[model samples]
Target: MGDLNAKVGREYDGFQGTIGKFGIGVRNDNRRRLLELCGASGLSITNTYFNHKLEHKTTWVSPNGLVQNLIDYVIVNQKWKKSILDTRTFRGCRRVPSDHKLVISKIRIKIQANQEKRRTIKFDVDNLRNERVKQQYEVKVGGKFAALIGMENMDMDSEESWAILSSDTKDVATEVLGYKRINSKPWFSDEAKVLSEEQQRLRVQVDDKQDLEKKQQLKRRRNRKLRELSDRMKHDQNMFWKERATKVAVAMEIGESRAMFAAVRFLRNASQEKVWRGVHGMLDEDGNLVTDEMEKRNLFARYFERLLNVDTTRYWDKKKKKSIADLNEALEVQEEDISAKR
Candidate 1:
């Protein structure tokens, strides 16, 4: 279920193996099949899937066109009663580095208190708060994975994580969406191309006028040079990302080689090669990294330090913004206090 789109920005929806919004018909069939398997009742499978809540507020495509509505189709239709050990199943995002956002829930079924604990319907609430906002605030899936309303996360690592990981948990991408293949980069439309072209032409004209007298001087070549520099920086950043991928591969024990990380690593390297002199270089009289920039750099460094150690919690709050973890933490604390008083 590969795809081609003019729109791109890491917003994949639905499961793996599904074609997403682009493959409506294909997804329809998959949805139907799922319906049969689950025997879901009259529910709106169409117009389901929610858009991810990120800075871009990008709507995700349903990979296989799977009946995202059918995710918890059976349970919801039947109105099955259940108890989740971890109420966090319905929780959403934690703002990780993944291109697409992911939602998580524990769906074990719960019975009467005296009944034997069934490991049927639950899992821990692994998703942070931002993810929950994305999930709960999704476009009218018309109540899709919502069937999870009455389920539970059975206390057990009984099988594996809901989203399976490689041998090492590091490379653990959620396999639930059923994406059939790796997503390709999206291209801009004709309109976008024309705009980019016009911008380029204007930039060239600006350069010609500004540097007409001293065009030959390196410093006078600012605009033209900026373009060249940006391309290089982009390349380097991509390479850096690739290099990071290898670390994930290594942790996952998936044998992801250095070669695999080459492209992103190159981009990272290019981005790092900035030639800022003067104030841009942050020199106090002596030309050193500036105080503010240095602080920002330090923050970035410390942030990564925590991230590298998988201190996901700390890495998040440093944003000083609202997030799933923070919400959940507050929720938990609130509950604990209530319990203590009782």
Candidate 2:
């Protein structure tokens, strides 16, 4: 939640639920930019949630008392929009120095006690494209296969044989083509991280100091560090996308269909397309969709089992089969004659 001074208008056309109809004044370039940021960050302007009079909604007024606008905003994550109890502008009896009015919000959020399991493995599949890595993978797999061949000599059940083969193959792949450490925020470069840390350190110094001049100096240093970090992040993103575009162009030119399509999907709007993330419901014998996981699985199993174990012998007619055989024989004889004449 922040006073991002964006005049998001009453017209919430593209913004939809993100910004409400109660917004004061017309939206300008800054408001559009704010809306774009909110959309990207999954935020919704919370002040628009409640119906309030213009006096309560308005956050700023001109010194001349002619113009009024709600420039201050409290934006929260869209998922947590409902958690916001209320948001309103309040005025004090005493005169205030700033033109902007005091805006307040009441939000309630529950923190989960249990922590999520940490994900350790970040597979570097891209590295496998290298010839050296490919050769190493093959060698590792071959060694595992040789060991599995020895296991095959021992008397084992069919299930055990399959399990051994599958497990060993996966183990070899993992050992040869190991995972890299997963950087949660890969966009934040090392330089940006250092600057952020320094900025926080300077902020601490500003808070500890009693001298106004010294505190202001520390604040200036902190702000400068933040700006530098922001610039570095923007530069990193620009360079990353530029490099990706080059790779996509090269892939398309070389006719590497798999790489080309993957790059195209990543670069284009198709990347935002909704994908099927779970098991699809299958139709049972009754032709009704069975969405329950266990039922669907059983239905598919029975379907494939009956389909594969069909009586093919009873399906074909002997008379039709005889005709097909006769036609094939005649065609072969005609082809041989033609070859001889040539």
Cα lDDT, all candidates: 0.38, 0.78
Residue 42 lDDT (model 2): 91
lDDT (tens digit, per residue) of candidate 2 on 1-342: 566778887887777878877777877778878888888889899888788988899888888978888888888888888899989988672275888888889878888789889977656777788999889988888887888788867899999988888888777667877777655444457787898889989989999999999999989888899899877766665455555666887888888989878877765743343322232345689875554556767987998999999877755777678889999999999999999999
The alpha-carbon lDDT assigned to residue 310 of candidate 2 equals 84
The TM-score of candidate 2 is 0.40
Residue-pair clashes per candidate: 60, 0
Assess candidate 1 and give its lDDT: 0.38
- What TM-score, over all chains together, does every model reach? 0.18, 0.40
Report the number of the highest-lDDT candidate. Answer: 2
> Model 1, which residues run further than 4 Å from truth?
1-130, 137-139, 142-202, 206-219, 222-231, 234-238, 247-251, 254-342
